[model samples]
Target: MGSEKKSRLPAIVATAVAVPVAVVAGVLVFNAIAPKAEPVHEDLSPVAVEVPALSEEDAVVCLALTATAPESAGGLQARPVEGGAGAAESVMAYGDPAVVATCGVEPVAVEDTALVYKLNGVCWYSDEAGLEWTSLDRQVPVGVSVPETHEQPVDVLNDLSTAIADKVPAAAEAPTGCA
Candidate 1:
């Protein structure tokens, strides 16, 4: 009886080890044979951007905002800026046509009748042509320029709003039209 029990223990231990080994081997083989999706390669040339001189306070805010900005927005990856000094800290660009954003820019001038939108805890105002969208609720307004090629430009704004909300502080008062 003792001899029989010892024999059975070895079999049970072997089965346990063999099962896991087989599963790992199968997974590795399957992965090796699986089809892989092609990686997307985008032109990462540094984009040229112009920014007004920033106040010390505004520069601090811009630095914080850009540091926390996402690597990708609206399905497009962030790209470098062309300016030699301080531009990369204040500006970010994305996509082929380049959805460009400049931090610490002058706020959008909102007329009494203009439409103001609050999305993802950020308020926004868009230009008549919808090519430009600016944050109306942040301490320093963030301006994002969308190309005409993007059909739904506001969608791109929505993607960026969350980061803007998190990193940038709310304005002392909401924009005139935005409650």
Candidate 2:
């Protein structure tokens, strides 16, 4: 009885060890053969914009400008606008509010205190914070909101100027003393 019991103990120990080894080997083989899943990307939702109303003619011009706007700005792809208000305007946003462009904005009143920048044959008026830029030379005003994250806002303006110039007609003249 003792000898039989000793043989059974060795068999049980060997079976226990073999079972675990087999499970580990099976897992490794399955991992090697199974297809790898593609990495998941973060969902970038559209930015919410509040746009002002526009005149009929201005709305048409805005639509044209929006249609011609670039698909991407500063390496960020354009996304749809959400929560917009007003008539016949379009909003183009990129990268969770990194850059935003709105057409059909009311013409900015260029005050003596305003800072004006001229680039790519277009004139832009900036508010005190310089966060917003309104095109002063277009018949129908267009505004671009550039976040502080951008090192150079002028580069973004330059990139969009061609589209604005091509689609939106230029005013007879820009505001006085605006360069």
Candidate 3:
């Protein structure tokens, strides 16, 4: 009886250890095979937008333009804009401090020294301060304010460029150095 009990003790210990090891290995294998979750922005609250005064025609154009704004920019999801009826003029936003868009803005006045970049057929007047970018070729200028935290402003612009091109008309006088 003593010998039988000692033999059973080793079997019990081995079974306990093997079961736990098997479970841990199975979990690791499952994790490796499963699709990874996409990164998500923490804040989804309405972003505050300071809407500018726009002409009746510009306002109408802006409303239509904003309606076509992209659902996502730079892999971030769109959030609602805060403020009053003026906020309706704004395009969607993504992330905290937000990558925001406002349409029907006054044409950007660029000096010869100003930095202008043509991206996806849209001419952008970029102000390094606050990372603001305004469309220089659109009839009713569109503005985008991207937070410094955003790693890829160009990617964000790329996402919105198609929408801007489809909805906003080109200005008669485009900024110099643009395609």
RMSD after CA superposition, every candidate = 5.7, 12.0, 8.0
**In model 1, which residue pairs have backbone atoms overlapping below 3 Å?**
none
Q: Encode model 3's per-residue lDDT on 25-45: one tens digit a residue.
A: 999999999999999647888
Candidate 1 residue-wise lDDT at 104: 86
Q: Predictions ranked by lDDT, top down?
A: 1, 3, 2
lDDT per residue (tens digit) for residues 7-114 in model 1: 899899999999999999999999999999899777878899996588988888888888888888888888888776789888989888789999988877777677
Off by over 4 Å in 1: 1-41
Cα lDDT of candidate 1 equals 0.86
Worst 10 residues of 1 by lDDT: 105-114
**Top candidate (lDDT):** 1
Q: How do the residues 1-179 of candidate 2 rate in per-residue lDDT, one tens digit apiece?
A: 99999989989999999999999999999999999999855236767787767777877787887777787765666677776564225676765545788887778887665568877778898876777999998887888898887767777788788788889898987876554
Task: Please tell me which model should have the higher lDDT, number 1 or number 3.
Answer: 1
